[model samples]
Target: MKRLRSKYTKGEEVKFISHLDLLRVIQRALRRADIKVAFSQGFNPHPRISFGPALMVGATTEGDYMDVDVEEDISPHEFKERMNEVLPSGIKIVEVFEVDVRDSLSSRIKGADYLVEVFLKKEVEGLEEAVKRFMAKDTIEIEKETKKGKKLVDLKSYLEEFYLIDMNGERAKFYVKMKLGEGSPNPFHLLKAFNEYIGDAFDLEYYKIHRKNMFLE
Candidate 1:
């Protein structure tokens, strides 16, 4: 058996699709491509496939990854080409490589990078100062809902990096690295803190967010 790793992209056109639907789409595409994918041995056998971190719905991503155990070895180039031919327009295979099954992408992922563009309802000033104030605090606590209940967390702890990339009169661009794994903070939580800090004027739903990179460590 050969373990293959493939990088795929989710464009804005399909950002609204839930993560489960995206997985289903790829599984169907794999079947249509006629690849000899391996399956688990059980009564209700499923594809021997694994995925990296799940991207939030309504957020586009370019660095998504998947691992599949296939029955036969296929060249990386041909594997990518075959999958792309079957995948939907918004999802495309970017690259494929042979991988050691032991070093799984999901297991190794440490964090992810995001670029968020907030289009202000109107030209708002002092956005840069707000970011600076957020960064300057000793402890930035924000409320987050967990499986048990809602809890307050220190936002500064889970943030690996933050930068104000650009700010035009009408839009503000922020690049942030959010931690993953157990006890890691969700980017959405940080955004909530930002919205609260900026007051109710800037709604986060109007933001254009994209996952630009994934960090494996």
Candidate 2:
């Protein structure tokens, strides 16, 4: 058995695909490439492939990672070439490498870095002051509805990094990092909280949002 690890990009054209549909596409590509992927032993056998954390819909990502177990030992370069030849547009393999079975992409991921570009239709005074005040607070509590129910959660603790890159009258850029694991806050949720705190200081919308990288501590 051989374990292969690959990094892929989800471009804007394919960002609408759900996580399950993305998995199906990859499986089909592997089959078309004639790669012998191992299957799980069960009543309903499935490929022995695993991917990192699920990506939110409408979010483009360049740091997505996946691991697959193949029955045949194939060189990483050849594997990449074969897969790229069959993969549909907007989904491309960036890199492939042999990985130790003991290691997993999910366990090693500590956080994700995102670059958000916001466009402003209008501006209000004291926008910067509101941002500073929000960042300075001891805790920012927001209500979220989960399967269990609506609950108030503190977002301050999960923010590993946060800063505004630039903000003109018409546009703004933000760089943020949210830690993963227990109690980790979603980056989008944090942005929503920021917008609410600003209280219509600026009519802001996310023009572009891209996940730049994922890191391990």
Candidate 3:
């Protein structure tokens, strides 16, 4: 069996697709592309495919990774070519290659980086002061709704990186990289918490949010 990782663009509208559906689409796409993917030996065999972490709906990515297992050996270049040929317009495979025999992508996925773009209809209220005060806090507590009830934790403590800048608002596009914990919320929601930290200074309706990139470690 051979395993490979590929990068694909989360095309505009298709970005709304749930991660589960996205996985199914790619599984079928591989079959249509004529690649023989290896299936697990079990009552209900399934392809060995996975994504870095789930993406929130309505977010696009330039660096989305997926691992695929194929039944036969095919050079990475050829695999990339074949997959690209079969993928839909919104989704295009950019790179492909054999992954390490022992190493896996999951082991490297430390967290994800996000970029959010918010436009100014009216000047954000107390924006500058809010940014300074929010970042200055050694820890920021956020209330998260859970199965049992709301759980409060220090979000700033968990944050690997975060920033609030204006876009042209271009780069003010709130760009942040955060550690992805098991069952953690999406970064977009984390932005909501950030908004609170800034005394609700950001205009949510005017914001055009997009997940620009994701990284491993």
The clash count for each model shown is: 0, 0, 5
Candidate 2 TM-score versus the reference: 0.89
Candidate 1 residue-wise lDDT, 60-171, digit = tens = 9898788888887688888899899999989988889898867677777888899988766656567778788888888889877779898888989878777789987777
**TM-score, cand. 3 vs. native:** 0.86
| Each model's lDDT | 0.82, 0.82, 0.73
Model 3 lDDT tens row, 86-115: 877788888777877565777777777777
TM-score on alpha carbons, each prediction: 0.91, 0.89, 0.86
User: Which residue pairs of candidate 3 clash?
Assistant: 110-217, 165-172, 166-172, 167-170, 167-172
| Window of ten residues with lowest summed lDDT in model 3 | 163-172
Off by over 4 Å in 1: 121-124
Instruction: Give one digit per residue, the lDDT tens place, for model 2 in 1-217.
Output: 8889998989989998999999999999999999999898979999999987777788889987889899997999999999999999999999999988778777878888898777776675666566677778999998877778888988887776677788888877788887776446677777778878776443445566788777754
- The reply for model 3, stretches above 4 Å from the true place, is 120-122, 125-129, 145-150, 167-172
> What value does the lDDT take at residue 210 in candidate 1?
91
